[model samples]
Target: MIPQPTPAAPPRPARILIVDDSAVMRALLRSVVSSDSRLEVAGTASDGASALRVIDSVRPDLILLDVEMPVMDGLSTLRQIRARPTRIPVIMCSSLTQRGAQVTIEALASGASDYVAKPTGQPSREAAVQALAQDLVPKILALTALGSPSHGSARGHASAFPLSSPAAPPRTPVTANLAFSTPPQQPPSGFAPAAVLIGVSTGGPAALDLLLPGLPAAFPLPILIVQHMPELFTKHLAERLDSRCPLRVHEAAEGEPVRPGHIYIAKGDWHMEVSAHSAMPDHHSSSAPVLRLTRQAPENHCRPSVDVLFRTAAAVYSGRLLGVILTGMGHDGLAGSRILRQHGGVLLAQDEPTSAVWGMPGAVAQAGLANRILPLNAIASEILRLSARSQREAPDLRETDPREAGASGIGWVTP
Candidate 1:
């Protein structure tokens, strides 16, 4: 009898480098990464310094880093890695504690790719292990397999696609592909806009890093952003964007008048709302909308939720608002975009492949809410085209030259 033929061996799993101070953390991370057949832990390091030392040998495609460590912190390690020529994506594991959240934000600004809040052992905490698998695994899978054709489908592992945000059982299946097959296209016309409101989460930091820098220095209208992050991280992101982009970027402050030629990032841990003053009673009042910060209960399990900001902006700006839903893991901006549509506003979404996770944008795209869906590279230029038509015919409002707005330099207002 002829011998039976054997099946070919499976492809090598994506190698992962685990870096953390705690042995338990490293072990847990390893288990999570290895849970799938397509991923395996390549090496372990107790600190950033040690991780750096072994990077050459391990030659990992991805790194799971702990934010705090005795010998070398995550941020310092990230900085050293960024200085090198090789480009490897890093995911940081940070605790929900104030300090942990803040430091994690700094790491993102310092060039870390993404982050996940460390699950706590307390009974009151969410399931740490489950959250890690659901959140971290998908990110690793997506980032490592970025341009691979086999992405976005169930590939024998949970990390093969972007997972749902906030750590829960997925409400829907992942997309089949994240790419745009056609060339970048222009959006519809006839609508004029006063301001830009963007709602993003999960993959926001890196997406914004790519987008904000691409806009022209003379880009009109202030851009209001709601990125689901801890307080310190939001502030750091604004600072980082300010340095990189032509637009003056800063954290949204209470009573600050939203203006043209600037970008206002919603402060972390606070729900950002747009409240019209109709010309405030104070002498400092302007016709522009006033920034309102509140400690309202979290929506969609987040304080500075995309829903909160988008809803209020829809109400305040009405048909004059321009809302864009970028990459995120949840449907936070869906309802808000619906409101924008109700008021005759324009909304755009980032296409799938460019998004780290297509949840937010997909939500709008699937619902038929987005007026136009463009690739990540195309969205920046579309913003200019969509808004410029109205801007050209726009009537000038009250303004005093700060000298900064005249140029592409940074602008600041004291609270």
Candidate 2:
């Protein structure tokens, strides 16, 4: 009789260290990790100090780090991990607030591999735990495959991501006029519009670092942004962006106006809306426009959710709104882009090759919601051309001189 064929050994499971101040969080993470046969919780810690000590013993393949904790916060822990030069990959867990978003961004800048928003309420909390497990397992496995040899080297070029650059004085507006004409090949079934709204996450800081500064201050149409970040971070982002871009950048405040030559960012915990309110009579008996913010329930598990901001813009600004979804995890903006497409909004998504996670934008493109998917480098030029075309067609009288606008109290340094 022929000898029985030998069977191959199964692959080893990934080991993870769970770190959070709450005992409930630790248990929830353990339950989620254990549910997967290919992942195991090697150890757990309630704070950064204990986490470091636990790391020496378990030598986990990955870490799930909570950003806010007693003793050592997530950012401080991340700094410590990087300082020790541990090759272990860490994924930060954060709240969906402006401050939380800011800290998470800092953690990523400091070397955390990626981030997931912490659950909001009880039911959402349970969902977030399950989602975190699903998201983390693959990242942990990938990091292990990349190995420690690549880990140290991977960090050497951290600054190469392009989150910020030195500011240059605003250049003279380009006079090139591009014409708008519907191509013979139009979007299928849906009406295509001339305007765009953009949302980004994770690698956004770096991506925006490149895109925003490149746009001329005189960019014609209004641009609305919803970047997934905590409150303090959004404030910081606006301040940082204001310094670099020729266009006016400000954190969206309730009742503020939205206009061209200006960029409005969603405030951390509030949803921003672009509505045409009945114009109030001014001193000259002319109608004045207004923009409003609402303290609405979080959409897509995020307040200031990209979907909420984009969907509202699509409803009011349809056929005039261009929607662009950038790099992020989860499917938050997919539905919104679909709404935009149905309403004649132009759609663009960042290509997977350029995204940090390629999950969010990838979903929209795969679903055929995007009209044109391009790499990060090409996005600004596309927007510029589109804006120029819109300007030629409409010849907007609301065009504000960017330099003069910047000087009119629109640009203020946040202390």
Candidate 3:
């Protein structure tokens, strides 16, 4: 008689350690986490100090760390956790206030994997609750040990959150569009970049800290970033990153001229784009490329969408723009990235294993739009390698039609 094939073993539940001073918050987190069978509340701690004490014993694969605890707050705890021999991923819990934003930025810089905003003053409690659940649970599943699939899920939002106690983890989704290899011909012989555009979300702050330090201060291109964030948080994140990196990083100012060797971060809720014409004499040209900010309607449900900046820059910079899609939770950068590629721009993605959530990069990779698929560490060097050979004078910025230069008529909410 022919024997039936043996079933494969199920993935072990992701062990999570919850640390919060408030008993209620800890309980709430536990309830949400334990409700999913794929996750297990490995242990709980009242504060960072207690967490440090029990951390080794519980041996959790991920941590849900709270920002403000009485003794040894989240940032301090994060430093200690990072210093440990074993690298356990920690997600911080943060308040949505300005002060909270500042501290949360610090936590991310301190090496916490990612963060979740605690519902503070939203108009409806249920709305806030649902937001919290939707935001926190999926992130936990994606960033935890449980989230790393042997193959990448094209869109983590769709299949990441598992409700049933299935015997096995679901296979990662694959799509025809994901880019597999660097385009054989792009970044053509005489390529020189006028600017570098980056789109990141989910685990961006920490990812930036790790990635940015690898590039030198003398790096030639002015790097612009669209990190999914709200007001106050983007400013704080830029401040935190600037202090650590050799390069100068700042939150993008509406009228500021783009300059080499500096990084401009997109301000929260505003679409940061480049003006084809710089009204005043500037470093790069007689008329410099200017920074423009608008409150355009959200793309991929994100304001300051990666596509907006990338698509606009493609018009202004021609083939001189380098588009990079880092770790993020959605496909925000894909369509915009396509526009850049069509215009001869070179696109790069952070490979799946190194990314906190491969959603955004995966989208680009699956679409076969990325010119290069790189790990976080190698991207900086690749930037340097590509920029060193870039053309000295940018293509006529005026070549693109004036109509594409302005994002004026689109619906935008007042900040």
Candidate with the greatest lDDT versus the true structure:
3
Residue-by-residue lDDT tens digits, candidate 2, 1-415: 9999899987777788999999987888888778777778899999988998778899887789999998988889878876663445677888777677777766765556666666556567668677766655555544444323211112211222332223312322111121213221234333323445778765566667677887765566667888876666778778777888887888887656666667888877777777655333442332323456777888877777888877777667767777778766567788887787777677777765455555567667667667677777878876665565565555563456646555433321111
RMSD of each: 8.0, 9.9, 10.0
Please state the error at residue 47 of candidate 2 in Å: 9.7
What are the per-residue Cα lDDT tens digits for candidate 3 across 1-415? 9999999989888888999999878877887787678999999999999999998899987899999999799888888876665656678899878888999987776556678888666576455556677778777777664554422342222111111113323443333344455443456666677889999987788678878877664455789999998878999999988887767889998778777767899999999888877544543543657788999789888888999999888888988888899878768998999899898888888876567678888878877788777877778777777776542343223223222344223231111
lDDT for each candidate structure: 0.74, 0.66, 0.76
Q: Model 2, poorest ten-residue lDDT window?
A: 171-180
Better TM-score candidate (2, 3):
3
TM match of model 1 to true structure: 0.72
Judging by TM-score against the true structure, name the best candidate.
Answer: 3
TM-scores of the candidates are 0.72, 0.63, 0.79
Off by over 4 Å in 2: 1-12, 17-38, 42-61, 65-89, 93-103, 109-113, 116-195, 230-233, 278-289, 393-415
- lDDT by residue for model 1 (98-197), tens: 6787677677655576797777663632355666787687677766653233222111222212222233233333333324333223344576788899
What is the alpha-carbon lDDT for the whole of candidate 2? 0.66
For candidate 2, give the lDDT of residue 350.
76
What's the best-to-worst order under TM-score?
3, 1, 2
